[model samples]
Target: ELLLTTYAFCYHFQSDDPLIKLVEDYKWIDFFDFHWRLGIDGLSLGPILLTGLITTLATLVAWPVTRDSRLFHFFMLAMYSGQIGSFSSRDLLLFFIIWEYQWNLIIHT
Candidate 1:
């Protein structure tokens, strides 16, 4: 994950324009619009890289965990993904969803 984050950082640095990797919309209600969009740019890449670093270090330091270690790691990775999503999401709804999920995961853990 850290390696991937580093690669993304390098890729973003090499690119002159913001990268919008994905854009998809899911309509569940007529009144609301939910777009699942993701991108990486100068502003967002920093947080993504930081999150990747911190999560990697956390996983390493949590090596001694014995009780429900698998579940713990699962949640950790989920939270990490949420963090990444929140950072990269280009849509307001997507960001909100990811943010709420991260908070819920943190509360549960």
Candidate 2:
């Protein structure tokens, strides 16, 4: 996770035009636009970096799990994905969905 964040930071800064937007439009429904749009910008970078740092630290601190280790790690990964998704989502619906998913994971855990 840290390595990925570092790579993203480097890629974000090194480019002359450091705007990376990935868009995958899937109109799965008839009325609404279901676009899986993600991007990294100056504002988004801060939270992404912070989340990476915190999650790395949390993983290190929670290394000595006695039982259900796989489940614990799975939750961690799910939460991390939700956070990163929420931070990088370019669409409002995507953002809301990720946010809700993160909260739901937290609640269930």
Candidate 3:
């Protein structure tokens, strides 16, 4: 994403020709198909953020009750990594992998 942002800015600032207009024409929405547009939206971003926050807060709240707070910390960290992975995943299979990554955390907790 950093590289992409850098490249985008490079094109926007360094080029002024009309032909350059064609290079950065794609919208973020274009990444998804028409069918996906029905399901994915700004509204969905809110819930994903909310759910991620809830999981993080729950883990923090459970710190004292967990038998070994150290182990809980490890598993919670794993979960946090997974949630971030899922948040950024564009491929369905990659998203599934991210979702599954939290299973062990569930079992351990």
**Which residue pairs in model 1 clash with each other?**
none
What would the TM-score be for candidate 1 when compared with the true structure? 0.80
lDDT of each: 0.79, 0.81, 0.51
Residue 42 Cα positional deviation in candidate 3, in Å, after optimal superposition: 2.1
- Model 2 spans > 4 angstroms off: 12-31
lDDT for each residue of candidate 1 in 1-109, tens digit (9 for 90 to 100): 9997787567545446665543344554556654556777668767888999999999999999999999989988998999988888877777888899889888876
Structure candidate 2, residue pairs in collision: none
Candidate of highest TM-score: 2
Indicate whether candidate 1 or candidate 3 has the larger lDDT: 1
Task: Please estimate how well model 2 matches the true structure, expressed as its whole-model Cα lDDT.
Answer: 0.81
Candidate number with the higher lDDT (2 or 3): 2
Error of 3 at 90 (Å): 0.4
TM-score of each: 0.80, 0.83, 0.45
Residue-wise lDDT of candidate 3 within 28-80, one digit each (tens)? Answer: 34555321111222333445455566766787688677577787677666776
lDDT of 3 at 92: 65
lDDT of 2 at 73: 89
